[model samples]
Target: MSSQKASRKAKKKQGGKQRAQRATSNVFSMFDQSQIQEFKEAFTMIDANRDGFVDLDDLKDTYASLGTDPEETILQAFKVLDPDNKGVLHKDYLADMMQTQADRFSRDEVLQMFNISPIDAAGNLDYKSLCYIVTHGQEEEQA
Candidate 1:
């Protein structure tokens, strides 16, 4: 084949690159209402005891069923997600966790989060900000 044909083939194989998406403030806003309702239904399934909340055991069960570990990472996440330390994960917090926990922070998101907290221009985050970031969802407004 001629070099020109090979070049065309290479170009076709390269395909188009996707642009990076902006972080949405309201995570559920991206989904259609039916999809959102389905998410709630899935949460209900995870609640196991029908106690209107999911505890660590429920989380472990779901994780195990999905062939993943119910290990430290998830434990720490639950600690962070269950800010009130109620030992039960409710639907609202579940939604907030889905909104906040799972995402790898984009640079813009990091900046936004940092800006909201007690970080100064010199790149120091005070204890309050650190505490806030730990207890509340990353994208949640000042608590």
Candidate 2:
């Protein structure tokens, strides 16, 4: 009876391993060879101790090697973006930002202008409104 139980456990373990392999293969098959290699290299960088797994220690070591504290970096960047130091970006401030060299309308401005019109039942702009906006409607003259 013990021998039979051991055989059954072995079969179950083998079946689980096979299922895991199949799942891994299906996921990897979505990417080409170059993409797979790139992902492997990225994973290797994140798995700093080379133990084939990423933990908090590995992440700390990786970030330490790069000499960057992500939280401080993000906070500094936000400070630069938020000149008034309001801790949040207002719509007008976003609209005035020089995102591109061209004179095209800012996305925030477009959305604000679109708010004047009635939205559809789904809270989406209809095809006609989309066309009017894309075609540079009377908003251009007003600007």
Candidate 3:
């Protein structure tokens, strides 16, 4: 029984190493040589402790640098993306994160901007004001 447990532990560690190795890709296929360096730079920024993988601790470290905690959604997203829970978050999910997280962030910004719009500067969200902001704002911007 003890040997079986040790075997399982060894297999898990080996699987982790295999996953790490399988993660490598031809950077040129996704980005040009110059862009590859930019990614490495960004990865280094996120990879606190100078480790190759950005784990949950790195996120906390990054937040410490910014003097804030990671938002609930961001924490959840990170947990979901890092399925192995090996405390090492593989970088491939970073690309997917950019797409998913970025969209939600931008949508939030739009909602905030709309909320503050002078379309209802009087602080009342009437139908007329909504229409004016929806149509008039674009016309004014184009002018």
All models: lDDT? 0.60, 0.63, 0.58
Model 1 lowest lDDT segment of ten:
15-24
Q: Residue 28 of candidate 3: its Cα lDDT?
A: 69
- Candidate whose TM-score is highest: 2
Question: Which TM-score value belongs to model 3?
Answer: 0.31
Q: Name the runs in model 3 displaced over 4 angstroms.
A: 1-27, 71-143
Where does candidate 3 clash, by residue pair? Answer: none
lDDT of 2 by residue, 40-63 (tens): 999999998899999867876776
Candidate 2, which ten residues in sequence have the lowest lDDT sum?
127-136
lDDT of 1 by residue, 7-100 (tens): 9877766643211233325688889999999999999879877888898677767877788764544456656655766444543334444556
- Predicted model with the maximum lDDT: 2
Q: What is the TM-score of each candidate against the true structure?
A: 0.29, 0.33, 0.31
- Give residue 3's lDDT in candidate 3 (0 to 100): 100
Model 1, clash count?
0
What's the distance in Å from true for residue 99, model 3? 19
TM-score: which is higher, 1 or 2? 2
